[model samples]
Target: MDGTHLFELVIAMFLAIIALHYLAHRLGLPPSVALLTGGAALAFVPGLPAIEVDPELVLVIFLPPLLFDGAWSIAVDRLKRHMFGIASLAVGAVFFTTVVVAVVTHVLMPSLPWAGCAALGAIVSPPDAVSARAILERVNLPRRLQILLEGESLLNDASGLVLFRFAVAAATTGAFSATNAAGTFILLAAGGAIVGCVVGYAWVKLVRKLHDDYLMIAATTLMCWIAYLLGEQLHVSGVIATVTAGLIASWYQHTVMSAATRMRGTSFWTVLVFLMEAMVFILIGLSLRDIVERGGGFGALLETMALPALAILVTIVVARFVWIFASDVAIELAHRTGLARSVPMGTGAATVLSWAGVRGVVTLALALSLPDAFPGRDFILVIAFAVIMGTVLLQGTTLGAVISWAGLRGTEAEGAPMTMSQAEAAMAQVQFAKVKSLAFDTDGNLIHPQLLRRYEHRATAIIDYAQRTEDYVPMLHAHFDVVLEAVAVGRTELIRLRRAGQIDDETLRELERDLDLEELSAISAKA
Candidate 1:
């Protein structure tokens, strides 16, 4: 298709995504799932030109920022607190699922190469953060449970994608060695982490010197790409690299960014991530026809690949449950025998975690990325799509019900603590200090009692007062600076609370948002 056609199609798909997302929200369905359905419908439209995406471009453009955002938003302290459990699920469960899916799928489709099966397995092993985040916003879960799941969501893609790269290499080169693969995986992971840290350090240091608002925002996006590209160039795990950069950046975000910069950057990232997510789901749907055609058409694809794909889908879903439950049981046994002090999660929470394994854009992107000459490329792609649809449609839609059935819905109790007002209430000390410390202007002159009294009618400064008197503008700005200082103190306290385990990540962030607005309001007070 021509560039004009491609551009038009993109616009059309974007419009469709907006409409479907709204529809899904109204109907209480997952938005990502709705976009997938819409994309599939658009695919079969008569006379519409085919939309072909370069897999390299897709990964390069889409994965970096998404991964970075996931890394940046994840609570490092909570992640550390729950590290062991998160690792077992994010790393162990993913590998276990990959192996199980590969073995079972090989049995179901013996003619398909083992390497291809492994690649397919890896494709479906990781759950997408976008899908989980959407549902999570609508329902609450226990703090520990939410931490485990969200943490897993952040790191599993790295593990699964690393495995995928190995599998694809094995397929392309007709070589397979578990020993070498394991060694390389470890080396790559470590190298990616190091590279990511360096990249993140450089980004923060560079941005600290920048004063322009838009440049700072643009630099963040650039930093994500740099992390991914550098990792890839260094022959490490780009996914891990990007994620590490994000994590480090998030840790220092408050200290490094000006209040206005932080607020604007947050808004920019929120919109960018949402758009990237919407486009990815729709692209997968739009690619459905091509996938089927390459697999020998719809009827032939069903006849040849349907059963094996079904078998693979079931294997991944079941494998997650088996591994999680078994691990929980093993942990429980260890604790009972006094062999370990780590407490096992409750069965209900375990069940909910296992069932929440919904595949999404990452799986589809991996499948689509397979080289054309790779054995069973089309077949693997179709299987990946099937797995994504099955998990998302079946598991995503009903995850809340499962949580409720498991008696961990957290509908009332868990939801109340993460509120903005709660965060503000926690900052009563800082607020009091802010008011008491507001006696002096920028020149350190204590205002007369009458001057303060006349300005006491409002918490916010009146812009007209600045026009009426030159001294009043500077005085108000000085008060704004005091407000900014108060915000800084609030941030320090928020960080302290997070580190001391006094507040959960959700609450910390909610409080951070409250302070951000206060700072912005102070700036606007004298604008």
Candidate 2:
């Protein structure tokens, strides 16, 4: 495709993805899933010419910002707590999954080379953060479970990508070397880390010097994509660099950024990540035909796809169960040894985390990026696609079922009532603080005397309302025998009149809103 045609296709893709994503979100489904499904449909539709997706575009343009956003949003405290689990899952589990998938694929499909199988396995092993974040963040996984899953997902991309490089090299050269591969992996990982930190630090310093919110936001955004490109150019892991940069930059969020800069950067990054995530998934769905066509005939493709998908699905399920059980045992040992305090991993939390592991774009990108001349590339592509679809569709759809079966739903009660007195007191404090902040100048001199006096009067009324909150609980129980009984009575009379069609719709709606406020007050006071 030429520049103009490619540009138009990009616009069309973005618009379609955005519209579909909005619909999915409105319908209470994850926008990522919607995008993936949409992408698949777009690819399969007749009369649509094949869409050319550049692998370089994905690694350079897509991966970095996505990884950075994930790293940025994950809190340091949460990341630290789940550090062991994340490390184990990201570094260890991926390798284990890759090895297992490779061995199984080689044994099952003897015609496919070991190296090719390994490449496909590595691509499929790491769950996508985009998918995990979309699913897990919205669900009621315990704080700890959410952290563990997110941390693992965040770091595993680097691990998978690194392994992918090795796998590709092996497949292309028809050779494999343990020693050299291990050494290269370590060097690249370390080099990527160094580059990320140095670049991130420099970027933050530049942003701080500029002190322009728009410019800062733009620079940070550019850094995400730039880090990926630079890392790839250096032949280090781009995903690693992106994640590392995000972490380093996030560490300096408050220290380096002006308040306005921080606010605008945060908003801009959040929106950008959301849009990219939606687009990636949609593109994944749309590429179904690309995978199928590239893999050969549908009948032949299905035969190749079925075994690998089943193997991946089974392997993931079994592996997760073993990992979780072992991790739990380790957690117990740590508590016993006084290395950590015992924090219960509720059944719901554990189950949800296991089920939330959905494969996504990273796998598809790896599949598509495989060299055309690579032996058994078509088979590998089919298997990888199968794994992605099976894990995401089957596992994602049934995760909630597993959660319910395991009784993993949140224990926290929804919208629990609070006593009126407590609510009134809290609201009073907020009102008083706002008033005080407005009344006083930075030098401690009073400003706007007339407005200050009026504020003082309103503040006193808030204080009085706050005090009445203590009696609110009893008053509500006694049907308004204490504090503002007459006011409540008048409001009830107004509500009844409105209900009887004695007031206009707007007046009735206004009265209903007031009634809601009063009810909230009473409920708060009771709590």
Task: Give me the candidate number with maximum TM-score.
Answer: 1
Worst 10 residues of 1 by lDDT: 458-467
Q: Candidates' lDDT values, in order? A: 0.82, 0.75
Cα-based RMSD of the predictions, in order? 12.0, 8.2
The alpha-carbon lDDT assigned to residue 338 of candidate 2 equals 92
Per-residue lDDT of 232-311 in model 1, one digit per residue for the tens?
99999888898889998998888888877887898989988888988988887888878877777789988987888787
Maximum-lDDT candidate: 1
lDDT of 2 by residue, 7-36 (tens): 887788889877887887788766666677
Model 1 earns a TM-score of: 0.80
What TM-score against the true fold does each predicted structure earn? 0.80, 0.77
Which pairs of residues clash in candidate 1, taking residues 3 or more apart in a chain or in different chains? Answer: none
